[model samples]
Target: MAELRGTNPYHIKPPEPKVLPKNYTQGVDNLSSEDFLKIYIETLRYQDPFQPQDLSKMLEDMTRLNQIRYMNDMKSFMEGLKGWFNQITLLSSLSLIDKEFVFSTNKIDTLKGGQYYLLSSEDIKGATIRIMDGDDVIKEYQVDINKGLNPIELSDLPKGHYSVQILKNGMPVDSLNLGVMGKIKSVSVSGGELLFELENGELVSPSRLIYAGGM
Candidate 1:
């Protein structure tokens, strides 16, 4: 028999160590606090008994988790405060809509021999009032504001149907639809001069008129 020259089967090469891809632990940082806590507990349960986790490392991880939780709470509180302030500002602006004012006009109808007036309780200081008849520019005047009733004369205007406006510093101040009131309910022409019946039931000459309307 020929001597066996075959290589020894017991000389089998050890299996190559398994190689893992890089970035395998990249997603671990995205785990929620609860999930990370559960993973840590499981890792400790199965960790090799001889190589225990360090107490200092565990304390550091817990401290970092607490800091993250506090920061999240602070961010939530700031967001709520911002929402509350915006609501307050909106309510404050809405409060201005309820205020009323009284305004005056300077439009006079010269041919008709009468003047017009407007009455309102809304503030009209620093406003401009314009008077128009059909397509004609009768008169325009600025509102002179005072604490109480303000009087504006419109006797120099032309006679006809007239309209009045209330402005504040050249801008419309209030949207209240003001109505006109006569100095007296009825007027009687006397001495070649037109008279007016004011809403207060007082009879006065057109020249003595201040405002043309009432609120």
Candidate 2:
């Protein structure tokens, strides 16, 4: 208005478009393959006649659905195989526990003679006892043991180092090697049972002993 020549006006910039995160839809699993196919077909039928959905985009969506189906099937098979392997391992461990076995010692103190007691569970049947002198049989005794705890006496045997063997029905059950002659130090209880402590500081259970003599 005041005779200004070519006055320029201020320009306004448009705001930027908002970017949304992917996977905005929920409840995708509720739709099955058949439902998806029906929806796609109907969209093609009723979509704007001039401006329709791109064929390439529709093909990509179908490919993604097939991949999801394959992944779900694979996951189910792997879960079943894991359960089977766990059962097999549990059965193997139980088999080892049910087998009968013996306990023995290696340290022989070169004792001439001593008294010892054998302890065993009441259910142990057909019990037999034997004394061995370095692969040579010294004496063998038949024992009639009742349930709970039974004691056997092995006296009058000259011993340097002897191995005691317990058998059931002619099969070897358990064995232990006695050290040199020593006196009883004390008796103690472990796991609710009595153990004989020898003067040599060796602790033995009555179950580990097959014979007790000259006490």
Candidate 3:
């Protein structure tokens, strides 16, 4: 057994008592303007008269709090308005389902070849319509065009995707453009984007569409 030595009172100092900060406004983070005003009034009533609270600083804080609340309210209102607009857009898009819509493109896909149209600004005689399969030209037609829509028969071509081009005197025509017509099967939203499904099982954006109406 070891002999016990007497402890020095000065060496073993007692620990000081813990002092916690008194947070009077604790848990008031979500307080409304009215609630804050009530607290402010109560504080003024209970404060010691000799040691007055800082009136200017308190008023400034109150003004700042009001501004913050106003901004938060405006943010919520704007968000709700945006949601309403999106819902309206979706509702309008739903009307396009089962309707025919035409989109502008130079490409076409067909299971069995179908009829397509070419629009010319002026009368173009002996303009060449070239149907391309990759870099290879599968078919070519020398045809005369009117100033309006000219019907082209693609029923003779094979079933696949092809690029269509109109050329005049071996130079590409500028005024001529191609439009592909399809029926809308459905409309949907994905990742906040609007999408339209076609009868051919293809998904397209509404911005690409130039025309939508009954078949």
Candidate 4:
């Protein structure tokens, strides 16, 4: 170590860091197909006088660059398609307002009395219909099943949801749900998707609906 003449002699200078231009970007981060092609040309231009570049390796690199470029283009196209579909869906959902729809559910909205139907695939003479609220039996009624749409009317039930079970041969064979008629009240956006708000305090997706009647 060289001796210093100043009083403070233990200090050492840190090396200055290399600076890049403001527009300079790293090849590893922003490398594209054009940049890669330019690199290939430059490599060929500055090749060795004796030994030359391997043609196979250069072709492999070109192929990889082309594949990456194609994938990025496809990604952009798919993103555009998604945006168009969302726009169409938003426009269509707006027209669904104030329209009444019936979905397959166990919910039944009753005022004085409501009509419920049983769709039988075959003919049957006697089968019991049990209206249930969850595990508890609310009401037990009989339906004249005849392999068709059998309508059943019960006394004024509470304005809520109920499930109907079909009992044949003193045992429950099948179970179906009584649906409620609801009208769309308004629309709301949630997570970039549209939600249909019903008059009965329900939020559902327009895609989930299978049947819709007049406004």
Candidate 5:
């Protein structure tokens, strides 16, 4: 048999060693603490005898490096914690599905009709219930008010989202309190905020909900 002159295809070649310049320590953002220490040692070995490196500054740099590492580790831990919290929130909210909850809100989204209430401090005459679609008032109802919780009844308007405002004497009531009751259809998250989709089409935040109970 002829002597094997060609290189063997199955033979694996060793990777080349990485070489750094003498006393190299320029870019170190990606370097680990051990790698940085090795570079620091090399820097000290090749440092000029007439103009030695500043000991205090070197110590400060090492301290800063360790601090950066610590901060990075903390950031990773926080990210994991946030993920865990979101999962918990999602799991917890699933239990509220099909359960009735009384939440506070000023908006109504429904196909047929909607139910809401106004928490009035005092009875006032000639108050207007202004249903707003964007900036325009789509519907209005003139009615007298009563102290405590006053029920608001809305007819089946077109299927859409609308904002409800109580106006007294043509000015918006600044201290208006509006609330609604609906069964939870679904639960979701948006921008890290927990949200509940009501059976009547309202999207409410958990922070806004004041009461929860069965239908």
Candidate 6:
């Protein structure tokens, strides 16, 4: 049996109690101005009769209260403005789900089927536009690829989803989704950002959009 070197039964110090802030106007339903006036009246009633109270300090307290209330009002106004702006933004995003979109993408969609524009980000000629399904190439088109909108006459192209692959010198340089002309599938908020989910299972930002009402 080992003997304890040091042992004290009642040597521990008691912890100090935490002090909370005093609510000066504790359950009163009156506003700040009313409460301040009530306190001022009570102070004057019981103040020292001989030693005059500082009227300047009381005026300063009232001024401070007004300033605090003004600031609170302005803060509420700014919050309302921000909420209105968010509502406008969300409404604009919702509109995209109905209108057709013409943006630079590889996934080409033809909802109405009249004409689909194929655009290139790079200036390269002799790039074969190969229509692809999965990894297999379905059809190829020989056209002088330019760095701007190149229209593909969609006379009878079936309304569906298709992918476009651009090849340079018989070698794959870039595979892009063909331009889409269809309504966005849905609009949702993810991670505090508005996302437009297209019919091709693509998520796009509404800010970078080009609207084409129809094919």
Cα lDDT listed for each candidate = 0.51, 0.53, 0.73, 0.64, 0.73, 0.62
Candidate 4 lDDT score at position 192: 60
The best candidate in terms of TM-score:
3
- Regions of model 1 farther than 4 Å from truth: 1-116, 146-149, 175-177, 183-215
Tens digits of per-residue lDDT for model 1 on 5-65?
Answer: 7443334333333343574332244466798688778878987889987746765676688
lDDT of model 1 at position 46 = 83
Off by over 4 Å in 3: 1-78, 111-115, 212-215
Error of 4 at 125 (Å): 5.9
Count of steric clashes across candidates, in order:
37, 10, 0, 0, 0, 6
**Residue-wise lDDT of candidate 3 within 1-215, one digit each (tens)?**
99999544334433333233575342344576798789789989998999988867776776688667657666776666555555556667776888876767777667634456776679999999989999889789899988766767685788898988789999998897676787889988765568889887878888878544432
TM-score of each: 0.29, 0.32, 0.58, 0.56, 0.57, 0.42
- Model 4: per-residue Cα lDDT over 1-215, one tens digit each: 99877322223322333344687543333466798778878988999959888867866665677668657766776666555555556555676788777544555446423345555567766788777789998888776676545555657566666767888878876643344455789887676677888886778876656444432
Number of clashing pairs, model 2? 10
Single out the weakest 10-residue window by summed lDDT for candidate 3: 11-20
lDDT of 5 at 133: 91
lDDT of 5 by residue, 42-159 (tens): 9789999899888678767766886777677767766666655666777767878998766787577664355777767788789999888999978888988876667776775677
Q: Model 2, range 1-215, lDDT digits (tens) per residue?
A: 58766322222222333333484333244467798789889988988988987867765676687567657666665555454443444333343232222223442223633334454445565677777787877778887655433444567666466667777898876432332333445655454445556655666664554333332
Any runs in candidate 4 off by more than 4 Å, and if so which? 1-41, 45-55, 106-126, 133-135, 145-162, 169-177, 188-194
Better TM-score candidate (1, 2): 2
- Residue 77 in model 5: shift from native, Å? 2.6
lDDT of 5 at 110: 63
Off by over 4 Å in 6: 1-82, 87-101, 104-106, 110-114, 153-160, 175-177, 182-205, 208-215
Measured by TM-score, how close is model 6 to the native structure? 0.42
